[model samples]
Target: MGPETLLPNGIAHYLLGGLLIGAGTVVIYGATGITAGASTFLESTLSYVSGLPRFQQFRFTATRDWRVVFTLGIVLGGALYGLAFGEFGWTTDVQWWRLLGGGVLVGIGTRVGKGCTSGHGVCGVGSLSEASLLNVSVFVSIAVGTALTVQALGVSP
Candidate 1:
């Protein structure tokens, strides 16, 4: 089955979102000469959060405050989209603690993986980087395995 039935909107709606993201990626690269990646943005935000001068000296955040703005825009865009769709409800079937725990694990995994799926799968692979190709392979394999394992265990997460 196609995503049309599973999604709240038509395929065109999803396509538009993809197009917008692609345009944004191009714009970011054109403006900053840097491929946009969310994880690195978060890492920089964390550096600022920790209030450590050493973290601020890191190559990631040393000269890239715009990344933090880009990250905030991403988050704000998501919130605005949900509000626009009138589907802004956040009543999840999963427990809060489970969600928090999962978020922590994902954060850890992103650091260990050196980037998130957006970095490796979207930008890196698009750039034809071999390391990103390998990372995407491992990421997809593990994600598929996890989904299948959850299905086997009848877990709803």
Candidate 2:
């Protein structure tokens, strides 16, 4: 009645997927000695554009070559998942500007906070990084506050 009620594949499938992700993370760490971070993937991709002086300066593309491939794999895997699940056309009833603003805010937050959820929550926490712990605390706090504010404003689902 738990995951069976929530998903057709049930709890075992969820656990197996999580295990696979954890194992993959471990494999990545063992091979590269680097934590997986999605924002850095964006950085790597942005480093290609000649106009982006900041990305050009950072040289993420040069240092993170394999991660570019990893990021591309992630994108492709997501597309494959959407096709398999048949939810490719899903959308939120929000304005395009709202989505843009949110993306911008997330980019800013990742830069200021040093990393995003995959880096801090998964790999960093696994490594017992103090900064990651603090970052995660602030992240959860802000998320809770935002959810509460939205609920109070009666704009939540």
Candidate 3:
């Protein structure tokens, strides 16, 4: 196969998306002194409905508003993109129950890991945080292993 066929189309779109995410992360930190991580934002948004002290901490409550807005922006942005120019349907053959189970496992993993990839990979790694670096390394290693194992098991999706 030629080099042109080796790469997917819309490569520029991916580049632009990455740049925008990085820019948004920087702007969020520069303006509000908060790290723009989705998992933390998810936790902070729980402050409104949950009475749990873990979600009611000063750090989460103090910046919950903007975090909520940021989270909304992420959801809306993806929706907008799909509405504008993309396959606007669920094309995956994966079952809803499997998806739900995977999401639950991911949520638990994030809590145990203390953060998600966006926190450790984007903001933390950008700032050269040791803990973030370590977390990201483990994240990548596990992800690679999981993908390989699934592929070996003939999982197709």
TM-score of each: 0.84, 0.80, 0.89
Q: Give the Cα RMSD of candidate 1.
A: 2.4
Best-to-worst order by lDDT is 3, 2, 1
* Candidate maximizing TM-score: 3
Please report, as a residue range, the 10-residue window in candidate 3 with the lowest summed lDDT.
Answer: 2-11
- What candidate 2 gets wrong by more than 4 Å, as runs, is 1-13, 51-59
State the lDDT at 10 in candidate 3: 43
- Tens digits of per-residue lDDT, candidate 3, 1-157, equal 8746765674787789999999999999999987777788777888989999998999889988998888889889989999889848887898898889889887887788888878888999999999899989988998899999999999976
Candidate 1, residue 130: Cα displacement in angstroms equals: 1.0
Error of 1 at 28 (Å): 1.1
User: Model 2 misses residue 143 by how many Å?
Assistant: 0.5
Candidate 1 lDDT by residue in tens digits, 20-44: 8888888888987877777776657
For model 3, which pairs clash?
Answer: none
Q: Which scores greater on TM-score, model 1 or model 2? A: 1
Output the worst ten-in-a-row residue range by lDDT, candidate 1: 55-64
TM-score of 2: 0.80
TM-score-wise, the better of 2 and 3 is: 3
